[model samples]
Target: MSLATSIRRNLFVLVGLGGIALSAQGAAAQPLDSALAAAYVNNPTLNAQRAGTRATDENVSKALSGYRPTLNGGISAGFQATRIRTPGALTAYENLWPATFALTAAQTLFDGFITANSTEAAESQVRGSRETLRNTEQQVLLDGVTAYMNVIQAIALLDLQRQNLAALEQELRATRDRFNVGEVTRTDVAQAEARVADAQYGVSQAIANLSASRAVYRQVIGVEPGKLTFPASIERMLPSNVDRVISLGLSQHPAIKASQFAVDAALFQVKVAEGTLMPNLSLQGQLSQGYDSSISVESTGAAAVTLNLSVPIYQGGVEYANIRQSKELLSQARIEVDVNRDAIRAQAVQFWGAFEAAKSQIQAAQAAVAANTLALQGVREEWRVGQRTTTDVLNAQRDLTNSRSALVVAQRDRVVAAYSLVSTVGKLDAQSLRLKVRAYNPVTHYEQVRDSWAGLRTPDGQ
Candidate 1:
């Protein structure tokens, strides 16, 4: 080959490789599934909720301790001096060193219903905490989905704006050529230039929006988003019946379950308070050894056992007042359960309606895009033939741009609405979605610690 041709071919190859590199960079910047999964695992809000749930696991131990014996031990060493004096008689003084040690245990034999009811209440609290954590997870997931959809929509709109700008640039060049030939006015070229500038501005705004959305996505999911691939058919992801959704939400929604658990816990509290008005019986045992030089050179040891009963006569009516307060709190909890149920039902209906509306809007926007594209093409042809004014061409371009933007928005809204509906029905958990993360188990920790007090006692069951 000639030297000039070889250089030209090399330059073309370099340009092609550069274009590919740019394309790859753009693709790498897109949010992906792995990013979302990482975000799901590492999000701080979700982690905090998990920590809160773990903290409640301690309640199980606190409750179970009531059924177990408590053992305590202590040791002390001290010095003492005593003196005796009589008027006009000889005085006597003595100094002695003493050491003492003891171990004691007590077991509750009966406490009316306080211990049992209190333990039950703690168990209910643990369950409530678990449900609250699950609810937090659902909220985080929904936020992640919303931010993801927003970024995708913004990217789509930015792409549309770029295409619009390219078309306007071409029209500007054409209008300038026609004006040079004295066929079109300078106003045509000026309008085309203004449209191109407007499209560029839209692209800038879209980019800014995408950045903001990505920040929110990162905030919720706890990691930077990688290249993302969304489901092609978002409508198919939605459930059909609002009634079924409401039923599921009422049954499984964490807020509703938590409220119910609160009521149960409050009922137990009332029982515990009423138990305080009765009598408590406990068995206590102790073993001790002491040494005193003044009394003996050797140590003395003693063992004792006792039964104790505590009968409450009066404490300013505090116990009764507490029971009354618990009853009122229980009533509030019941009301909360009702409120949560109604709220879930309303949210389900709204999300279902939104999903359907977004679907319809998508179809309408798609048709508008097609119609606008054809109309713009017709106007361009007419302009070439000096049959269409500059304003008509500009109007058609604006319409086309609007249709494209609307279509992107509608597509995003449909996906978000579908996810919202799923969330409203309380089925947004990892198990429900079959997500590939280890499910958090609250029971194992609770079981590990609940009976720990039994192990704290001496081998002889002190």
Candidate 2:
């Protein structure tokens, strides 16, 4: 019989403990999408970053406040006592209760266009924050993918180890039976027993590794891993060419976008600093009513309006210092944008290379698995027919087990590399994936709060 057919026939002959291990492998494994969805909703890291993004949206409204009027009112009541002294007249003392109430309104008419420039800067910062959120989403989703794959890989390795142990045990029993019938020596049976014990140790180690992977899955996905599904390789989803991947990263990666906005925000800061040396114009109005009760009660009311203009001659040299400082910051911000661009380009190239390497590894490993499978079958038949020794059969079985394990590892690496490559180009976001969840729009809160006239509460009533 052909060696390929022989392995299959022998595999079917396991109605024993080995068959149970084979059958117990995950039939309905958990889907990768499910883990990502869970992490999107429940991951503390992502949620915290969302909160940070929402906080950033408020800065725009604060900058816009400079263009709005402010009104304030106050009231004061107190008792006053006064004594008058004259050289040739009797002293007079007056005791009274006095109260005053006033309302004031102030509005900025001009401030070298500081309000407008500040508002623009804040808006750019909001854009930067939104991009930061996008980057965080990619990171979290990538983590979820990694964790899910680790669980699947761990389960596969553990199942393989269990099967190896079961196979070794059966081989040990067969060797002892042969020895009892005088077909094999005691040393051969002893060697088989030693192999079975070693296989048991390997099974124990696999169990530990699988447990550790499960814990990591729970931490990243916010729940225990349950029946992890076999990952369908996403190799076909890769870009057609490496150049396209780098192009995507440079144009669309969230980190690069965030840095671009940072540069804009810093430039606006320079404008804001320069505005401080220009003239400031404003309007102020006040109304006051006062009541007094002493010998006789009296009340008075007054109203006034004022226009104020301030030109700074020299502000203790602070204005020029601030302008110079902001210019330096602007320079730094511009350089950071280029830094982000180059870094993401490197990442795109690196992950693409990893994906290519892992793809090749999978192909080579699969070939090895098939070859080792055939070898094991041939060796077993030769040993039975007295052409191969028991040691040769055992070595062939071990080689087949190792080849299968290698194939499993290569498959896992292939999926992880694909995910990393996709993430490096910033396509691993919820919007890109079309995930079935309520998308958190930072603009929602910004729009609701930007034009608001007055409110102490946040847009979400927080």
lDDT of each: 0.77, 0.82
Q: Write the per-residue lDDT of candidate 2 for residues 358-450, one digit (tens) a residue.
A: 778867866676777788777877887778888987888898788778767776676788888788777888777767778888788778877
**Tens digit of per-residue lDDT, candidate 1, span 352-419:** 88888988997887667667767877887787888899889989989978887787787778878888
lDDT of 1 at 156: 64
lDDT of 1 at 213: 79
Task: Tell me the TM-score of model 2.
Answer: 0.89
List ranges where model 1 is wrong by over 4 Å. Answer: 1-36, 84-90, 232-237, 293-300, 454-462
For each candidate in turn, the TM-score is 0.87, 0.89
